[model samples]
Target: MYKLICIDLDGTLLDTRQRVSTKNREAIRKALDQGIEVAIVSGRPNCFTIRIMNQISGRMGHITFNGAYYRIANKTRQFPIPKEAVMKVAKLAQKYHVRTYFKNKNLSLCTKSDPGILDYDQFKSQTPLKDQMDMLYNVDVVDVLSNQDINILKIFAWDENLENVRKMREELKEIEGINLYLYDENFEMSSEDTSKGKAIQNVCADLGIQLDEVVCIGDNYNDLSMFEVAGLSVAMENAPRKIKEMVDKVTLTNDESGVAYAIENFVLKENE
Candidate 1:
């Protein structure tokens, strides 16, 4: 039986509205009742992840920052990007006017000046977060980065110019100690050892559960790594056709409660 369910939040558990569906929550609670563990794994920061967890009513750990950080109970293990690497990407983003956002320990941050429209959900203007400051810290981004105590979890630059992205890839290719990847138009940077697969492996090892005892569901390029390590992988119908080809099964779209569909038909039914 599967002991762990590692699920991606955006485009997997949460619909385009960026809210967890009731059906999805029910499935998750069912799994929890069945003695399985469910973890919210996302490319978002802990602040947003905690908000999402609060919206649901089940016990779950979090693998946020695209697997660069793992949190269970109140304790956490994080592989924060080095200060130098964080600044490098931040400076590059500023130079290219890429409209970037930074995830630090307590609050997320963005340029107080006009950084232009960002594509990430949390950076959007109408996010459901109650406290605007808690959702993001608008400040002099460069000055904020210079502060030595800042524990950065992730750096994201929205993809507006393909040419700029290409240029960045070529420029940062040799940069040591950082891992960068594209999810949609966004350029996401984190620590070299951070990834969903690696994080899940680490969590599995810690929980004394083998990789084969895990089931993962996601719908993006970042989710590809988790698919590699999961015993069974479910791709959302909204996922690209290329991603669907990579997983064991494809469920309904997020709007259609794909997570719930995957769990009810695959996880719950099989156990029964």
Candidate 2:
């Protein structure tokens, strides 16, 4: 029997509307009742993930920044990118005119003013939690160099033009000491060799649970690592065809309560 489930947020748990469905919440609660641990592992930061956790009733582990940082109960650990690497990426992002968002231990920051970039407040309001969420309020409009002394957790770089974003990713690949999660029009940068697979391994070791006792579900390239470590890996139906092909099983789409479906069929039924 699986002792734990690691879930991805964006395209697996949350639907296209970016809200957790009632069915998914009920399914998670059911798993908790069965003494199974559920975790929210995502490429998003703590502030955003925490709010989503609040919506679901029960204890849940958090693995964020694609696994660079994690908090289980009161114990927390962070693996920050090297300062020099952060500076290099920041400079390159500026040169490429790519919109960049930075996250430190405490909060997030937005620098590199560009006409193409949306107004901070407007951008914040558009996210899932809207104004209720503390979207980018930490060090608003600060210079990247001024915050060099701070420990940087994650960096998100993107561009309106897909070509520009793709090109930026290519140049970013040449830089050492960093890991990149490539997407269609954006990518996430973190300390070298960071991945959800490693983070889940650590969490399992802490909980005395073996990797074979965990089940992971996600819909993106970032989730691939978790799939590698998990005993049973599931991909959402809405996930890209390539992603689905890699997983052990494919569940319904997020709009169809894919998370709940996976839990009910794969997790709950198997336990029964």
- Clash number for every model? 0, 0
User: How far out, in Å, is residue 180 in model 2?
Assistant: 2.1
Q: What are the TM-scores, per candidate, against the unseen true structure?
A: 0.82, 0.83
| Residue range 134-207, candidate 2, lDDT tens digits | 33522333354555577888888766767767778888888888887787888888998578999998888888
Model 1 C-alpha lDDT per residue in residues 182-203, reported as the tens digit of each score: 5555576889889989899888
Error of 2 at 8 (Å): 0.9
Q: Whole-model lDDT for model 1 versus the true structure?
A: 0.78
> Which candidate leads in TM-score?
2
lDDT for residue 140 in candidate 2, whole number 0-100: 34
Span of ten consecutive residues with least summed lDDT in model 2: 130-139
